[model samples]
Target chain A: MSEPSAPVTLAVDCMGGDHGLSTTLPACARFLQRHPDVKLLLVGQPEAVSAGWSRLKEAAAIPAERVRIVPASEVVSMEDPVEIALRKKKDSSMRVAIAQVKEGQAQAAVSAGNTGALMAIARYVLKTVEGIDRPAIATQMPNAKGAATTVLDLGANVDCTPEHLLQFAIMGSALVSVLKDNPRPSVGLLNIGEEAIKGSETIKKAAELLGAAGERGDINFYGNVEGNDIFKGTTDIVVCDGFVGNVALKASEGLASMIASFLKEEFSRGVFSKVAAVLSYPVLSALKKRLDHRRYNGAALLGLRGLVFKSHGSADALAFGYALESAYDAARHQLLARVEQRIQACVMPSPGAVA
Target chain B: MSEPSAPVTLAVDCMGGDHGLSTTLPACARFLQRHPDVKLLLVGQPEAVSAGWSRLKEAAAIPAERVRIVPASEVVSMEDPVEIALRKKKDSSMRVAIAQVKEGQAQAAVSAGNTGALMAIARYVLKTVEGIDRPAIATQMPNAKGAATTVLDLGANVDCTPEHLLQFAIMGSALVSVLKDNPRPSVGLLNIGEEAIKGSETIKKAAELLGAAGERGDINFYGNVEGNDIFKGTTDIVVCDGFVGNVALKASEGLASMIASFLKEEFSRGVFSKVAAVLSYPVLSALKKRLDHRRYNGAALLGLRGLVFKSHGSADALAFGYALESAYDAARHQLLARVEQRIQACVMPSPGAVA
Candidate 1:
């Protein structure tokens, strides 16, 4: 991990998510304590953020000068559509937070809001980075190797062409190289089977493009990987269409929660089981902490001209804090510049390097 | 569950899978002991089936008359391509076993062979049932309710049209209604989101067709469901294109295995934890047994003229026994006729009821 620079500023949407100010305010307070040199542009209703900030300033030991409240008249509700958030609610906290990055007031923006609205606003304001057609949400899933596997197009574009898949691979490689400090991370194209003739026509064509790209040394392309490979850590980045990736992500969440419920039921079935649960609590808790998905809460909205990270809509204080920390890391590590350079080098090669 | 009829015969592919006779023979022996009324037509090289049958005969207490060895000149190896297994190896065990169903000698067929080869042979021999354009593989996945949720198109048709998905719903409905004893089981169209306008164009169109089918009372259709819905037991059946279904299934398998490994690591890290592991062993093992994937081994190849069940290639004796019992149950419950009736009633409605 690179050392945090002295002047990395983040614009956070405080009036977003289910808990809104309740979760965002406390997470911001704790985040500031950990990163003393970081500056924050809190975009929300001025009164709410102001009152909460004054209350937390003394307790958190964060100087009043290091924090700023950017006024936003409207709060984007969780159910707000993309059109409403972008065209109608122009001054929404979510949009204003992103505007802070677009206007060069902050290095990055963070939000725990409606995903569609967040993506819409970010794309509208910051625009796409050169050589990218559509932006994708890239996030890390906990893998068997005890490390995270990056997966892209989590829920951004439902219908992706082979070209879009290739773009996702380029952007994902850049994101991983910056975030994980791995320059040549391997990319796996998610498919039903590992063979070339295994998936849909679109996927087969995508395989050809990815294979060619792998030959050119643009990406460390790992050929077709199945669904399980995402959790198996078979590759550093698994690229898929938004529809499939979204299904896989939510399915994992649903299964994890169900297993948790099952574990709870098994441990509390009766007296003997309850005693056993108490004795094994520490070991189990450690395992739970090791595999805590909340620690990987921030999903980068990659392929955009400016940096924006999305937090899960139902994140708690600890989870939101992790989101803030990830945004900080991305900004400190210069994720935006690296994404642009990678896209330029790989997608728009110089005349001499061109085929 | 329906009781097995007096004369239900199943054609077994004795020379498929990794262990060939080693796993298939032992599983068959145990299966016969439990299913007294069922007769087996063991399809393989006559000499091998004869030798294995004679060795397992006295110990398994099976009447020699109940088991018959049918000669197949060649065996369909795991690595064989569809073209090879179909045209070249016409008398292959997998093909010959399926031929038994075609010739009306057996009510059903079971094989643990190369999936592509088996599907090709089954489709070539059995043909698609009246209205079905293509065949689909439907299997049960363990859910939190201590029951299984049947999902269709697991790895059969990677690129399914809207009509193909609708057909899958009909076949899946019939499969569940017959096997699970639910006359009107709800069928869920698997999508990225729960909303009506959530997924790809094919999914959206499939939803409209399914909604119409639900209105006609041909099949009980649940609206759009996410990946988690499968394990949540949100519906009796979940339908998707094979690519998505395959990815979801394999991803779940990977995640489950990873969690198992994680549990072992945590419980054996130290001496105290080791002792704690012993104390929690019974509870954990009970949980494992309750959610064993092996128990859900058999995948029925639906939309065919005859019934054919595919066991997991790596299934052990107990799991293979379950596959046999499932195949027996399908035959006893008349799954093939029920599927035809459902398709005829739904797809080819009467002239008076035409839209």
Candidate 2:
């Protein structure tokens, strides 16, 4: 894409995730086996990685040179993301993995560790891109309309200013360019109502800024969208502060769980219902595949100086494998640098310049 | 409850909801038929109410004296919650019903109108309670644990201060006491993490205030609770700003839809899965019943001078019926007066101190 740069190498935090190396190592090995040209720098405790390596080798032959283990003394727990990232776990596997990206040892980094810790490490070491105040994590959400919509600030900056939200919109638009493949992505500010005048004075002001920005052709702002609009694929990018984004993300997950429970009851009502279920099997399978989180493995932390991706904490081998590929794609696309340059090019005189 | 209060009559907005007056009028008629001592004031266009009333008489022999129709000139459309609530037909059923409560002709009011409009009208007419800065809508969410948990600031106040959140906790506890029969309800602040230091400065300050209040036995405060903690039924009342609460509720609804789609796919996978679906019918149905919004209708507009319930805009007959029943329950229980008394008794330093 950018004059065919050398093959990308990613630092994988092997000790991360719920199951740790038991799932991470095999996934990395499998991913390498599938993409021989790609390289991996596995950062974790040596003994644990070695044990997992042995099991992976015994199960299937792996190219020795394609994967290398970089020993690190600590492993950040699921607890206190900020404290561990800042103080206690300076030499942790996650930190070490991030350091590799900062030092140019690897093109990108991928981790299933504590999200806050990952974010903190990325912000502190790699630093925010020029013209960006805070970085945000943007993930692709499967919509009912058979399209994947990007929702950002999934849990980054809890309290955000209008300027911060505008930055997120720009970064998110850049992401959609690389990921969703839309040249001009349609962005919507997540709000209680679609009306421009709806929500708080802060939101109302943000809406005006977004509208002005859209008119200037800086970012494709589609005005305000509501909670239900997320799954309907109403817009390509949905922006919100981390607090709202986090709650929206979790709430969607909760709603999915509730719906699953409801359907199980509906189809089990009678023998006739059971027959209808069989008749609808193919359609249902397609729908499940569409909704599966495993298919969309990683979320990119945008507005940063480097590429960093966060996989689901409960991610298994297949999901983790996808995360690696995602990181490789982000690195090759030079997403971070592209977004930074675009934002810098559009510097405005007022606080609402980008708005 | 407060010496029976002279048979409090409720004005039901019969033209509201998706099912319209066809469902609303019969439900009100049935409710009045069961409670012979209670009077029903149907507020809508007189002809429509009479038509629906005739149907109720044919279906269940509803007594004529128990119900009366107060003609309204118009019906509020579902399109605009704010605009329609303010500028649209002055004689709309929702407005007239609210007017009845404001005029003291009815002790309380129930509406299945646009949520924003109901809130707007309620605030404009009933006004805020004596020491309450804002009126918040509180809903009873039925958790998987087979208990209803009260989640407040559903959609009334989007932006809230620490003092507002603390007041919500106080008001929510009182509502829970009336609805769930929990004398001293456990109140929790919904946050990203459990630790007191986890959220924004606003949340932290609110947590300190809540801690102080809990120490004095004013309300049972359960420290900080995360989004997942909601369905666990860990606390009797969950307090948050309106934005978070609205997103959480919608997200829960979305997640439920997603999960339902997943299970339908799983059940129709094959013959074996189909058989499992049949076997699990009763258990699944029981679970669905627990999640059904119909049974848990009527979100109370707490911290208000009068008892007002906001039913879901998409609610069907059963949910509207529940709204009527809930409004009746709140009036008969003198819920608002109880809340006022509780706040004055607990939070106020002295009898003459401001609430």
Winning model by lDDT: 1
True contacts kept of each: 0.58, 0.23
TM-score of each: 0.96, 0.87
C-alpha lDDT (0 to 100) for residue A344 of candidate 2: 76
Worst 10 residues of 1 chain B by lDDT: B346-355
Model 2 TM-score, 2 decimals: 0.87
Candidate 1 chain A has its poorest 10 consecutive residues by lDDT at A346-355
Please state the interface RMSD for every predicted structure, separated by commas. Answer: 2.3, 5.3
- Computed on C-alpha atoms, the DockQ of candidate 2 is 0.27
* Residue pairs with backbone overlap in model 1: none
- What local lDDT score does residue A75 receive in model 1, on the 0 to 100 scale? 88
lDDT of 2 by residue, B211-307 (tens): 9999998899999877765776778889998888887777666555554555666677788777766665665566557767788889899877788
Which stretches of model 1 miss by more than 4 angstroms? A1-4, A194-197, A348-355, B1-4, B194-197, B347-355
